[model samples]
Target: MTQHETPERGARLGRACGADGSGTAVGGAVVLLPGRPGMPLLSPGPVRALVRELARAGGPDGLATHVVQHADGCPERAVDEVVRRYGDVPVCLAGYGSGGLTALRGGGHPAVNSVLALAPCLPDEKASAPPEPVKHLAGRQVLIVHGTNDGRADPESSFRLAARAKKANRSTCRFEVHSDGHRLREHRSEVVALAVDFVLGSVMGGRWSRPVTDALAAPPPLGLRMPLASGFGRSLRG
Candidate 1:
């Protein structure tokens, strides 16, 4: 794990080198925004797995990965800080749950080339004011993966976001895991592969081929029910 020069807010940053044993500063960077009340910069479940998969893929030469933790749950500010720290390198934004929402919000930053959001927790239009992120996401290449059976954050929210992005003419994609829940541990491998492909393709100028696109759009088998595993629950308290 590597540490960055401390930011003004004293937020801790963690880094992992590329899998090819390439030096840390060469390839594109992926900045992971943590979920609510973010304590651990890197979570232990699917998020961790995704990071590992990306590292193994060895993005361009440098391919450094980073996670920024925010105690106040201010993911927007965290993203800005990461952008400042990384300078001119291409950066892909990603997050889960509340962090996913933040990633969507931060995707509009000029420094962020792409975004990967998993089960993003979007604000309810009826409950409160519309989210600020929705306004800034136009023209971004965004991919959202949500579980149809997600209880903590409704899958409808993702559907709604997709509709809005389409209306705004953003390059966006959405995938639904039929029987999966919020954490989506059962589809962990698929999620990691999809995220890596989307991010790498965006940063490396690779095409989003038909096979990958089809796999992402394909729905889960009918009545498929994968048993919930430990550490797969969405902790409301964060």
Candidate 2:
């Protein structure tokens, strides 16, 4: 456990289960935006596991974790709150499903070092289609991690996000396709490991883009031997 610093101004504070109570400021400050409204910040179990895993792997000293719980369609509101609190020091948006939509939209902030959107939900009704927020993430360091077998947001969404990001002058955008579902329960540990490595590398080393041969290379999850199709989805929303 470490100590907490009450910034001189702008602080949106809230707590949930598994919040990494060490109170110590690890590698810079990180603002973790959970799922949108109606969806809890820490989704009960597996997602919490994912978070804990990231916090553990993030660094040797451990990083600070803050969760933003806002309503649906109010990601902008949460983004403002995050700006108020963290104030441009490498904000990490960790959202799932539509929450990922919220995270990407929040990227306009200058302090945002990178984004980790998992199974990001596109505004499109079609599962295979990309979301509307894909266009808003230009010039930002974004890592779209999706599951090949995802049923909710579809596996191709990551591809769409990556393609749009790449086209938008952000060549460093990364996409990690895994072999799991919307929740990524099968590769929970690997997900966090990637998240930690990416965040640390981005903040300290300014490295966010993952090396990829082809945008749609089929690979296993992070570490597991699960046969899966991994690649950036096609951008359908423009």
Candidate 3:
């Protein structure tokens, strides 16, 4: 892994690139962005797991992984800097929370082929609106994974985004994990696996076979189906 810090428009931009073990140039790159007050790029457990999964799937000639850490709060600008630096290399974007929203916003970039947004923080009517309009997402393969029980960021927002993307005829998929919360720490392994599969298959030309899609469509087993706790339960008992 090679680390570099360059000044971009008065803000310090930090990026780390991990080359495939083959020591050969890879055609595609996966750019992982951190959420607000971004941590050291790729330091997060989920991000590291995704990178490891990518390596295992693609082997030594697979896509190179690049993580961008933002110095300021402007995630959009951070993504722009990465786009400028990467130039023509086909890039896939992935992030969590606010960073995931930023990745969605950045998906329209001509250089970005696909996006994986994990529990993205969607724009609220009272707060700031989305950085980019839904129309900008046309023609991109987008995969959004959000927990239905998330309190910090509503999962419905992801559904809305998917709806808009679908209306625009873009290829989009939404996976809702029932009973999972904001952090989604309990479902990290499943989330990382789906994310890696989506990034590789959708962005890097890997096969998005039926089995993969089937697995993604299936809900996690964490959700519980219980009998009603009130009159319904009493009626059943009666």
Compose the digit string of candidate 3's lDDT tens values, residues 154-204: 887777676666566336667776667777666776667667767778756
Q: What's the lDDT of the predicted structure labeled candidate 1?
A: 0.63
TM-scores for all candidates: the values are 0.75, 0.69, 0.73
Query: Global lDDT of each model?
Result: 0.63, 0.54, 0.62
Candidate 2: stretches off by over 4 Å: 1-12, 15-27, 44-46, 59-62, 76-88, 125-135, 172-178, 206-238
lDDT of model 3, residue 43: 57
Clash pairs (backbone) in predicted model 2: 2-22, 37-71, 37-72, 88-111, 122-131, 156-233, 159-232, 159-233, 160-233
Q: Across residues 1-238, which tens digit of lDDT does each residue of candidate 1 receive? A: 2223432332554444352222344446677865776346567436877777677764434565667654454456645555555556566788888888878877877767778888888876675665444656665677788888888888877777766664564466776777778887777776666677777676655655443444334443211112222232123111
lDDT of 1 at 198: 79
TM-score, model 3 to reference: 0.73
> What TM-score would you give candidate 1 relative to the actual structure?
0.75
Minimal lDDT window, size 10, model 1: 221-230
Number of the top-ranking candidate, with lDDT as the measure: 1
- lDDT, candidate 2, 78-101, per-residue tens: 445444543434556667777777
